[model samples]
Target: MPHLPDSVHVMTDDTRPHTATPTTEGVWSVRGTRITADRTPEGLRLRARAGAEGLSRIVLRWRLDTPEDARILGDAWERGYGDLQWRTLQPDRALPWYALITGGAFGGPTTGWGVRTRPGALCSWTVDESGIALWADVRSGSLPVLPGEREVDVATVVTAAGPTPFAAHEALCTAMSPDPLPAVGPLVGCNNWYYAYGRDFGPDAVLRDARTVVEYADGHPVRPYCVIDDGWTEGGGSAPGGPWDTGLPGVFDDMADLAARIAETGARPGLWFRPLLSRTETAAVRPGLLRDSGFPLDPSLDVALETVAEDVTRFRNWGYGLIKHDFSTYDVFGRFASHSPAELALPGWSLSDRSRTSAEILVRLYGTIAEAAGDAVVIGCNTVGHLSAGLVRVQRCGDDTSGRSWERTRRMGVNTLAFRLAQHDRFFTLDADCVPCTPRTDWRLNRRFLDLVARSGTALFVSVDPAARTDRTDADLAAAVRLALDGGTPGGVEPLDRLSTTAPRRWRSGAETLVHDWAEPWGAVPLAV
Candidate 1:
């Protein structure tokens, strides 16, 4: 047997003195939970469960022999969609291989943390780290386990083994995902938010973009898509509920017709909306619980869930083939990107229904959207990645990349693609975000970012501004579209420098190795006309 790290079980309930004794092969009985773990041919199989005492959290911590110089990598709780504070942990001040809990706080579940050693290892947790610590579920507030509950089944947390970090993550995601990977082809398309910024865009603007997609397609076997983001709302503004109508009167005029028009351009039509936040008009008709903002519908209520399903169903009926729902995590927790999942736990507050765990609530909500969406592909943004895993067909895995700042694009876009790229089809088709081709950004940098997106095998969304039409005309964009639609290089591309830098300059896509210095600005951003 290969030498293995000794597993040390750490539990919150220290007062109750307990002894762990190896009772069966690769299994130990500690406190009320069974600690079963072993090095398998694939990797390590680790699980903790309690049938009588009702398990909460059981962390199997292992220590490094030297702790001399150690580095750790922990994934962001949700993709960078909130306050824009959460960063990939590359602790500035080096520690003796031990770092503070950068993952979920003491009250929640930390999905996985790994040392910079190989074969690369990745751990996936069943419960949110928060629940095990403070008894607060990720979505729902802390709820005490009822007495005499039959059993507490904490999901299996697999510490996957692989020759590289990317491979380990791929396996970890595969182990964690509940739904089978979808047989989705390349979703190379254009989104309006980067250029429109939710300010002004309607039927004509969307149709024009859709036409660009068709022109860019250039007779590709796989069709392109045009997504009308944000500004299409009726009486646009944030409030709860909706007439849920499409576009303000005279803007899109008729949504069903608008969708047909985009399809006529040989492109699929997609729409982006904050499902929980609604206009005042929507609020009046289907009033339900409200979040801290006093406008966004509280997802904790049953009635609000019904409203959500109804609204999503309306979009499907309107002929939109894809629906991107954003900001539900922020709405439910009243916390944005700044707070980790652990920080969002509020023990005093309970949902309208306390029976369901936070994870359960989110699953139910996402599942509702999926069920109502019918055939329309659903993309979840500002959602918890672990919870959104199987529910959404596509997930915006990182924060928004900037059209105005090259640094922001590199930090947000390239970093996410490099680190979370392993989740490409496992959780959902990971979307690092659109390649913003606007005059405000440096095209040289944006073009490299676009190439990465096209070849990353993730969802490719290009937000082309009218001013940057020439920039989008570059042959690279079309070639990238071809590569993306063809499902990218086989053996799944991996970022070679993910652990070394926040923005990796090196990537290996099967046979070809691609390199780009994102920090090297090709030229200054052209002054806006």
Candidate 2:
């Protein structure tokens, strides 16, 4: 039988915990707030009503029945949120979305617990030997829920047990994300960011990339993509902010024409932009449209949303088939996913509109982008995976893979792909950044990564520098691109050593088992650079 939560508590702005009193079979109340838990086959659907005393968190507690020495696996807040591996349970660690427990033996049977919602609140888990707790963070930045707010549709808590950790995790992911917008075709592509870093490049360079990927594709039915990342806009470079109205003055004039030219190379054109930021003033700027100063537009405002929608519409209109929208999560929250719950957001500031929670605001922002994108494939980067699941066709599941450092690729790319691979197609097509072919990094290490991504049947994007291309590199690139375009191996890939390492070296691809060496001559760098 499944274990239900034993108690529910609310944490208000005063830092006091309020235990909810049972009012009905599946309902409870605290002061003026009402909490309801509806049992469904998937899990328990939790909802709440806020009172005059605002709430910061709604916690659900369950007593543990498992062995004392169980290992746990949790998730991250977004892409670039690394350090995913099964470890000894940490009571205070914030595990986003779900947590899986094993009996401390390698390849042992596993049990998983997770949350399912549109994510009206940011849900996380904390586990100890005696009990486990799930935290539903409903705070608007650092502020609590004030008076006269709408009801919060918290999250559904689900559980599953399986013969293996992979099976259990896959089941949990399917339960959590019931509806996902899957990619239309194999997402084999080339992006310029890793190689070019979005500087000293223009339409000519972009076309060269398009032609190269097409050449590598060798006329596969699933046409590859050539994405112009971050440098095309005026006043944009490596660390690009927006004012995305026009292309760079002389270098990338005629955006529509460039898109057409990219298509002429027999590759679909994709573009990247930071939608919530701008370098110059625009119609989106108003008193309530900004969180502070300097251009992170408040997504809660209608005008700001309108401006974002307009930018997306413009990208689609420019004849691009794919749009990679990035960095809104950092812009909205003023930080990356590298924060603890206590430091999730900057303190003492709320959204312009206080009627809704932060999760609701982010959902609305993603929805606006999706609706505006029309037929174009939408890829979300630096966006919350749990919230953006059903909206985006693709999601960058890890932090950036580096061209300059093999350590970054091993730590960020291999770790994220190995751990988050279960979310492929269940949430969105998982993109573990790029396979960067550059002079700075070894081809030996990168080719292994390239092969794994292609065989995994996930979105495979390679960034090839002009100087790095050789006869051998070209041959390898061709094989990987073709395999990726053909939808990988028949049964898809599975990590064999996930329970033991962050970067699994053994994989089961179709009927074949393959092993890879991800280490370099000096071994992995001590830090994730």
Identify the candidate with maximal TM-score: 2
For model 1, state the Cα shift of residue 78 in Å.
Answer: 1.5
Flag clash pairs in model 2: 80-399
Q: Residues 1-529, candidate 2, lDDT per residue (tens digit)?
A: 2455688888876377789887787787887778888887767888888888777888888887556778888888887445788888778888888899988332247878888736788888888877778888888777886537577888888877778889889988887888898568789999998888878998899999999999999989999999999889765554556667789998888999999999999999999998888766665643444432346778888989998999999989999989999888888887887633434677778877776778888999999999999989999999998999999999998988989898888888998888899899999999999999999999999999999999989999999999999999999999999999999988789999987888999999998999998988877778648
36-140 per-residue lDDT for model 1 (tens digits)? 666655444444445453433344433322122322344555675322222343323121101223233221222233221111011221122212111112223
Clashes of each: 13, 1
State the weakest 10-residue window (summed lDDT) of model 2. Answer: 285-294
lDDT values for all models = 0.62, 0.85
For candidate 1, which ten residues in a row score worst on lDDT? 117-126
Per-model TM-score versus the true fold:
0.77, 0.96
| Model 1 clashing-pair count | 13
Q: lDDT for model 1, on a 0 to 1 scale? A: 0.62
